[model samples]
Structures are given as structure tokens and as C-alpha cells.
Target: MGRIVALDFGMKRTGMAHTDEMQLIASGLTTVATPELIPFLVDYLKTETVDVLVVGEPKQMDNSASESEELIQAFLKKLKAACPDLNVARQDERFTSKLAVQSMVASGMKKKKRQDKALVDEISAVLILQAYLDRKPFI
Candidate 1:
């Protein structure tokens, strides 16, 4: 099976995560600058067999769209234009940053390391991928 990639996109930085070829578990990938994101994915896809691209869809606590949805939608448009044949999916991303921080604390990560926003973004991407995996039906 091909890998499944997830993206936690932000204004300046974007977090990335992907499952292994077996697609069994999700792992933190990397954080890239927003401007370079599309090119990076395009190059990565040339080398990797990615089956799906899951993007974090920000939502408010009341299930309304988040303030940054427009940004994401713009990004998605660029992504789709770049990889027209690519399969893309969206997963609701709520409280992922908070959960990532709690997880780091539970794992005994030092405050200095946990405070790294890039790391948090990466972890949040992993969480987003994991949540998508949990809801996917087994074949």
C-alpha cells in the first residue's frame, strides 16, 4: 500500500505527517515554510508513492468554520492546481495543538522543547493523521 500523508497547514509554517508504506501507523514528518509547501510536496510525490493527502480542516468549538478557513482553502486550491490527479481529504482539526502540548507534557518533554512551535505543529500533524486513521474503515 502507498503512504498516506497529512498536513497541518498554518499561515507561516506547515506541519507534515505520513504513514508507512503499510499504512499501519502515522508518524511526524516535518515542518516546512508555507510558501515552499507546494513545491516540497510536488517533489516528494515524485519520489514516494502517496495514496492520499489529508489536510487539517480547522473548525471552531461550535462546529463553525474557523477564521483561517479562507487561508486553508486558498492553499488547497494551489495544491489541487499543482497535483490535479492527487486524492485529497479533509479532517476536522480542533484542539490538536492543545492535545499535542498535553501529550508532550505527559511524555516528560522539557518545557524548552515543548515550547517549539514547529515541533508542536509536527506533532499536531501526526495527531491529525492518527485521527483520520482511526475513522477509516478496514478493508
Candidate 2:
């Protein structure tokens, strides 16, 4: 089976993660500046076959859509148009960022690294992908 990819899309940077071909583990891939994402993905896809694209869906605590929803919707539309055959899915990402930060602190990362937004984004992507995988069997 082809690998799966996850995206944590943000205004300034986009975090990426991918599963192994066996679809077992989700690993943080990289963080790219927002402006570089499309070209980067387009090039990466040329050399890699991805079966699914999981995008983080930000939502409010009460389950209302967050402000990022609109941007995510636009990105999803463009993603579908770019890769019509790939399955695109969304997973709620309410606490991924906070979880990422906590994880970094627990890991004893330096203050600078712990505060790195890009690193947090990448970790959040991994968390998002893991959440999606956990739900797949039920779906």
C-alpha cells in the first residue's frame, strides 16, 4: 500500500508527516513555509506515492469550526484538484498544538527548540495523523 501523509496547515508554515508503507507509524516529515508548500508537495509526489492526505481540522472547544476552517477548506479543494485520486480526510486537532508543546517540554528540549513554532507544527501533524489512524478501523 502507498504511504499516507498528514498536513498541519498554518498561515506561515505547514507541517507534514507521513506513514510508512505498511501504514504502521506516523513520523514527522518536515515544515515548509506556506509559500513553498505547493511546489514542495508537487515535487515530492512525483517521487512518492501517497494513498491518503490527512489534514488537521481545527475546531473550537464546543465543536464549532475555527477561523482556520476556511483556509483549510480552500486548501482541501486545491489538494483534491491537484490529486484527484488521493483520498483526503480531516481529523479534529483541538489540542494537538498544546500536546506538542507539552511533549517538547517533557523531552527536555532546550527552551529555544521547545518554543519553535515549526517544530510544534510538525509534531502536531504527527498527532493529527495518529488520531486519524486510530479512527480508521471504526470508520
Candidate 3:
């Protein structure tokens, strides 16, 4: 079986996570610069087996798409162009960063460590993937 991958894409950095072949648990993978994300994903895909690409779809409190939606859409288009065979999906990414910060605090992570934006990004990616996993059963 192939694994499911998730992405928390940002303007400056992009975070990634993936599930095991059984798709049981999701874990943080890495953070890459925004400009390098496609290349990074391509290289990773060349070596690993990925089934689905779950991207975080940011939305506002009123349920409308966030300003970043345009960027995400463009990125998604580029990603599809680069990997036509891959299946791409989207999951609601509301309050993921806030939840990531709370999780770090609850886990007793150091202040310095919690201040690392890349770390937060990675954790957010994990949350995005976990949400997908949780909803997979109903869908």
C-alpha cells in the first residue's frame, strides 16, 4: 500500500507530513522553503511511495477562502502539472497553527523550541494529516 502525504504550505516556508503504509499514524516530515517545495516533493516522490497529497485549505471564520487560497491554488496547479499521476486533496486547516502552539505548550516543549516557526509548521502539517486520517473513515 502507498502512504498519504500532507502539506501545510506557506508563503515563505512549506511543511510536510506523511502517514505510514498502513495509514495509521501521521508524523511530521520536514519544512522546506516555498520556492523549493516542488523540487523537494519531486525528489522525495522519486524515492518514496505516496498515494495522496492532502493540502491544507485555509478558510476564514465566515467559511470563505482565505487570502492565501490563491497562492495555494497556484501551487496546487503547479504540483499537478509536475506530477500528473498523483492524487491531490484538501482538508480544512482552521486554527492548526494555534493548535500546534497549544500542543507544544501542553507537551512541555521548551520556549526556545516552541519559538521555532519551522517546528510549528511541521507540527501543523502533522495535524493536517491527522485530521484527514480521522475523516477518512466517514468519507
Candidate 4:
């Protein structure tokens, strides 16, 4: 079996997470600057076989797509073009960042660590991937 990856894409930074080949657990991989993503993913994929790509889909409380949808869609298109065989999926990521912050506080992380947006994003990506894994029997 191949691994699955999740992405929390942003304008400035992008968070990444992945599951083991067995797909039993999700773990944070890294947070990379947006400009460095494609190369990072390309190099990462050289050693890892990614079966699917799960991207965070931002939405409003009323279930409407947020402004980030357009940007994500564009990125998805580029991703698909770059890796035609890879399946891409999206999961709703409404309050993941807020939840990540709360989790950090609850875990007794130092205030300085809790304030790291990249770390928060990475955790959010892990949460997103976990949610997806919970829903799919294949995972």
C-alpha cells in the first residue's frame, strides 16, 4: 500500500502531513513556504509513493466556499497537471487553525511555541488527515 498525504495550503506557508503505508496513523510532516512547495513535494515523492492528496478546503459557517477556494482550486489544477496519476481530494477545514491553537495550549506548550503559525498549520494538516482517515475504510 502507498502512503497518503494531506496539505493545508496557504498564501504564505503550506502545511503537510502523511499517513504510514498501512494508513493507520497521521503525522505532521512539515510546513514549507508557498514558493518552495512544488520542489519540496517533488523531492519528497521521490522516496515516497503517495496514493492520494487531501487538501484542506476552507469554508464559511453557512457552508459557502471561502475566498481561498479559488486559490486552492488553481493549485489543485497545477498539482493534477504535475502528477496526473495522483488522486486529489478536499476536506472541510473550517476551524482547524483555532483548534490547533487550543490543542497546543491544552498540551501545555510554551506560549512562544503556541504562537508559531507554521507549527499550528502542520498540526491542522494532521487533524485534517485524521478526519479523512476516520471516514474511509481503506485507510
Candidate 5:
């Protein structure tokens, strides 16, 4: 009924993506500075109808929590406190950045664009949301 938002939380910049109101397609939104992420989300939610949030959880190749997990956990806590009625979920984000680069290369994106970290982050958010949408069980 409402849009599903996904976030690729990074230390420097955070990426965002969202689904249509019907939750059919996942599209890249934008990358925001890490410090401005919460404010940006708060502002966006004020104007949009978000049913659920899918945040990318960084993990190591050995399935262990990455060093950034603590930061992400803190952010999650902040988000939960800020939006108690919102449903928030996490999706494994291993290799998402690598996959984004590979996808960009395969798609023949220009070198300048492919090198843009913001674009990579946005694409990573899209990938994370698509994975969540593909795997979530909707009743």
C-alpha cells in the first residue's frame, strides 16, 4: 500500500532507494552525506508514505559483523526511536558495492560515471532493495 525504502548506510555517504506505492519496482533515489542521513529521511518521510524500511547491513566474507556494524546499529536505534510506527528490516549487504561496479561495467556506463562513488552507492541501494523485494514473504 505504501512505498518501501532501502538504505545503503556508509560511513561517508549513505545511499537511498525506494519502491513505488505498489511495491513493484525498486529505483535508486540519491546519496546523502552520512551526517545528514537521518534528517533527510525524516524530511522525506514527512512528505512520503513509507510502509517499510530495508537497510543494508554490512557483513564480512566470513559472515561476521563488519567494523561498521556498530555504527549501523546506532543509526538503527536512532531510526527506531524516531519512527516507532515504522517497520525496519535489514538485508545482507556483502559484495553489494562490488556488484554495483560490475553491473556498471557490464552496462557500458561511462568511465566518469562509473567512477562516481555516489552513483555506486545509489546502485548498491537499488540492489539491496531488489534483493529484499525478491526474498520477502508478503502475506
Candidate 6:
């Protein structure tokens, strides 16, 4: 089976995560510059087969798409053009970032370290993938 990759795309950076080949476990990969994300994902696909690419879709409390959706939509066009055969999907990312911060606090990370946005981004990617996995009952 191929890995199921997840991305938490941001303005300046994008956090990446993936599941094992068996698709049983999820883990953070890394956070890369937003501009380089397409190339990075292209290179990643060369090394391992990826069944799906899950992009986090942010939503507001009232369930309307967030302003960030416009950015994500633009990226999606580029992503599809660059990786024509790669299957892409979207998952709700409503509270993943907040949850990531809470997880860092619960894990007893130092305050200075917990403030690292890149790390939080990476953790948020993992959380996004885990949420997708949870919703996929047959996976």
C-alpha cells in the first residue's frame, strides 16, 4: 500500500506528514517553504508511492470556508498541474493548530521551544493526517 500524505499549508511555510506504507501509523515529515512545496512533494513522491495527498481545509466556526481557502485553492491548481496523477483530498483542519499547541504543553515542552512555529506546523500536519485516518473507517 502507498502512504497517505498530509499537508498543512500556510502563507510562508507548509507542514508535511505521512502514514507508513501499511497506512497504519502517521508521523510528521517536515515543514518547508510554501514556494518550494510543489517541488518538495514531487521529490517525495519519487521515493515512495503515495496513494493520496490530503490538504488541510480550514473552516470557520459557522462552517463557512475561511479566507485562507483562496490561498489553498490557488495552491491546489498548481499541485494538480504539477502532479497530474497524484490523487488529492481535503480534510477539515478546524482546531488542529490549537490542538497541536495543547499537545506540546501537555508533553512538557519548554516554553521557548513550544513557541517554534515550524514545530507546531509539523505537529499540526500530523494531527490533520490522524484526523483523516480516524474518519476513514476502512483504512
Ranking the candidates on lDDT from highest down gives: 1, 6, 3, 5, 4, 2
Q: Give the TM-score of candidate 2.
A: 0.94
Whole-model Cα lDDT of every candidate shown, in order: 0.95, 0.90, 0.95, 0.90, 0.94, 0.95
- List the candidates' TM-scores in order: 0.98, 0.94, 0.97, 0.96, 0.96, 0.98
Superposition-based RMSD of candidate 5 using all C-alpha atoms, in angstroms? 1.0
Candidate 4 stretches with Cα past 4 Å from truth are none
After superposing candidate 2, which stretches have Cα over 4 Å from the reference? Answer: none
Q: Stretches of candidate 5 above 4 Å error? A: none
Instruction: Tell me the TM-score of model 1.
Output: 0.98
Q: Kindly list the per-residue Cα lDDT of model 5 for residues 1-139, writing each as its tens digit.
A: 8899999999999989999999989999999999999889899989999999999988888999999999999998998888888899999998999999999999999999999999999999999999999998877
* Alpha-carbon RMSD to native, per candidate: 0.6, 1.6, 1.2, 1.1, 1.0, 0.8
- Model 5 error, position 22 (Å): 0.7
Top candidate on TM-score is: 1
Give the C-alpha lDDT of model 3.
0.95
lDDT of each residue in 1-90, candidate 2, tens digit only: 888899999999999999998888999999999878877888888998888889899999899999999988887788778777778888
Question: What lDDT score goes with residue 15 in model 5?
Answer: 88
How far out, in Å, is residue 89 in model 6? 0.9
Error of 3 at 119 (Å): 0.4
Point out the higher-scoring one by lDDT: 1 or 4.
1
Worst 10 residues of 4 by lDDT: 130-139
Model 4 over residues 22-71: C-alpha lDDT tens digits?
A: 88899999999988887788888889998888999999999999998998
CA error at residue 76 for candidate 2, angstroms: 1.5
